[model samples]
Target: MKPRPLDGITVISLEHAVAAPFASRQLADLGARVIKVERPGVGDFARAYDTRVKGEASHFVWTNRSKESLTLDLKNPDALAVLMDLLKNADVLLQNLAPGAAARMGLSFEALHEKHPRLIVCDISGYGDNGPYRD
Candidate 1:
């Protein structure tokens, strides 16, 4: 078989809800490694949407396939350290965290670009950064 285009790529996503997970699923389908970062103890809120898939949420099952899930509390120093280490070698960082959440965790493109120059950071939010609605 031929190698997939994204066979050697790695993506780390701090996501919730549908959009970001959907995007990461596409990358995973293309053969990239996707690591989903969720809140410890709670995991992704989407996981609780409904148990329509053999006791699993249908939406969660659809958008989370072919990826790995990692629970982390970004507020914790050790967890933050783990994330920073992961970012060191990650090809891409995709996050759809609540408004200003990523920035609060120092995961913004501007903050991470210097340390991980080649890292591609994609922030998906309803409001763009620095806009009047940006919270």
Candidate 2:
């Protein structure tokens, strides 16, 4: 047996669509533990894109395998606390939320870097963090 490079890494992803999930899926494939955070009761929007895979969304099935899924409403204090606890030990935090979404939730790299110095925060957005068109 061989040891994978990411065998002990823990990835916590605040993702909804394809891009972030795709990236995290690759990490999981490399042996990282990927935990996907979704909205409670709603889950990921992509989950309802279509019922092409035996009642499961094809896109969801494709990128969500080999990972754990957790439902939490970031707006809820309790839920946010739970997520914060998870981040305490996570090696990476990957999010492809809407522009400014993560920042609005206080998940910006700068904010988290202070607490989790070693945490890698990857924010994927169509537009860069700041600029006239960052909306």
Model number with the top TM-score: 1
lDDT of 2 by residue, 1-91 (tens): 5888899999999998888999999999999999999998889999998999988799999999899999999999899899999999999
Off-target runs (Cα >4 Å) in candidate 2 are 126-135
Q: Tens digits of per-residue lDDT for model 1 on 67-123?
A: 999999999999999999999999999998877788888999999999999999998
TM-score per candidate: 0.92, 0.91
What TM-score should be assigned to candidate 1? 0.92
For model 2, what is the C-alpha lDDT against the true structure?
A: 0.92
Structural RMSD, model 1: 1.8
Clashing pairs in 1: none
